[model samples]
Target: MKLTVLGYLGGYPSHGGGTSSYLLESNGFKLLIDFGSGALLSLEKVTDPLTIDAMILTHYHNDHIADVGVMQYYWQLHAERPKEAVLPIYGHREDIQHFDSLEWSGATQKVAYKPEEKLNLGPYQITFMKTHHPVTAYALRILEIKTGKILVFTADSAYFDGLIDICQDADLLITDTNFFANKVGQKWHMTTFETGRLASQANVKRLLLSHLPEIADQDRLVQETIQALNKPIQVQTAKTRLAIEI
Candidate 1:
């Protein structure tokens, strides 16, 4: 299984960075995790947008789904598109308005996903866990069926005890580190301290700090996490086009 960081900045694009987005691939199948601001442009640098097999959204935030409409437009007007081709966008139905907008004419299909059910898409088996955010969001655990490699995405959430179990033994844990270690008592996103603690307690093999804050020093976030962990582990900050194999 291979994972690529398309965009990693938390809320908005700055310093030539985009918001949260990722691409996961296995056995020639491409799965897009989010389509945040500047994501489509970044994605075009790697692969054709029409080639994406499916997209799963964690929530309806603009930073997370900003380019979704443009993506539909791209498929609708692209001359090279197959006549029967249609993109499947997987999302929760908690926000009916946003969920309904996922379907765009015949260009895309909206597929609802329940947190309780497991999803089988291409070469992966996925499970969802609801996150503690203002809006309904879900963290995803994706397992490569053939390789048994696990990848967990924390999506957007605050620190919670359930996250440890959800990320347990994951080969890669991509966490939402949207705040510094000093920022505490927040309910929307995790801090570097919480991210480090989760990765350590969950025993993840490798850690990728994503959904990053735009103003903070990126290296310091990594260093703080390492200090909080107090252990040797392969840790890295997410950057556009950074690819890893698991």
Candidate 2:
């Protein structure tokens, strides 16, 4: 299994950065998690848009779904091959209009998912857990069926005990750490301290700190995260890719 960090900027992007997005590949199948702002441009650098098998939207937040419409149009722009099939996009029902916008290009199929739901796609078995965010966001627990290796993505959320259990024994934890340690109780997001704490408690094999807001200092965050853990962690952004043999 291989996972590429396409973009990790939070609500807004920095001069040359972008919001949350990741490319996960397992058993020759490609899947995109969140099409945040600037994600389309970053995605082109890693692989052909035409090759993506599916996309999952964790929520309707602008930073997370900004490129959803554009992704659909990317298909129609290729006139030679005449890509007719709609891309399968999984999202929540609360944001139907955002998903529907893809229909304008006639190149997307919307698949709604409920919080705490479970489903299978290719070689991955995925479970979605409701998160503590103002809007409906979900944390994902994905298991690679062939190897029993698991990955948990804490889409965007405040700290909660459920997250610990949901992420238990994950091979990797890709978490959203948008705020500083001072903002611990906020409802919409999590702090760097909480991000590291959750990973430590869950005992995940590896932790990838992401969803970083541009204003925060990366070095400081990494230092603080390290102070909170006994294991190794990586501060990742676009093009930072990791391959795991499960």
Candidate 3:
């Protein structure tokens, strides 16, 4: 099993085209986390564009869903005909409707898979927990059933109670650390210190931080977060094009 960091940022780049998207591959089954701004460009760097099985939207944010049209068109133009029959897109009901209206230049089918409370997708037994965000955001706990890899992706949320339990024992806790410690309350995103505390309390095996807003100082945030948390949790910033075997 492996997790590839495609575009690793909370917001769009100044020059554009960096992936906030992520791809998870296990036993040749591929699933995408969120399709942020640079999704198509990043996916092309990893595997054949047609091999993508499905996409899971964390929320309705543009940075997370902007590339949906582009990807659909790519698959329609390329890929074998049989593989392009239809694509399963899993997300909240609102998110599904939002993207379906797009005029994608693709001769493919779009299938929407709503949570309907919770459901199992292949090896992933997933449950969408409530999160603190302006929109209807969800915290996803994906269990890689065969290897017992527990991953928690708290898609773009402000810190909230019970978050520790939601992320407890996670093999990898991919939290949204969109700002520095003192930069809390600037918006709905979590501060660095807050993310560190959550990872420590959750006892995650490894903590990979992402969704970084460009205006903060990365060095100071890492140092301060390490000191505040005081745990051996592997806290590190995510980089684009980096792949980690989980």
Best by TM-score: 1
The candidate that achieves the highest lDDT relative to the unseen native structure: 1
lDDT of 1 by residue, 42-90 (tens): 9999999999999999999999999999999999999789889999999
Model 1 has an lDDT value of 0.93
Could you give the C-alpha RMSD of every candidate to the true structure, in order shown? 0.9, 2.3, 2.3
Model 3 stretches astray by more than 4 angstroms? 15-19, 102-116, 184-186
Lowest lDDT block of 10, candidate 3: 101-110
State candidate 2's TM-score: 0.90
lDDT of 2: 0.79
Clashes of 2: 0
TM-score of 3: 0.90
**Per-residue lDDT of candidate 3, residues 1-246 (tens digit):** 789888777778544536468898888888888888887888888987677776788887888877877877776776565753556667676654675643344443444545545667766777778788888888888888898888889888999867898899899988888878777345688888889899888888888888877655667767766875857987777777778888
User: Which should have the higher lDDT, number 1 or number 2?
Assistant: 1
For model 2 the local lDDT of residue 68 reads 80
lDDT of 3: 0.77
Cα lDDT tens digits, model 2, 102-161, are 454457788876665687877898998889888878889989898899989999988898
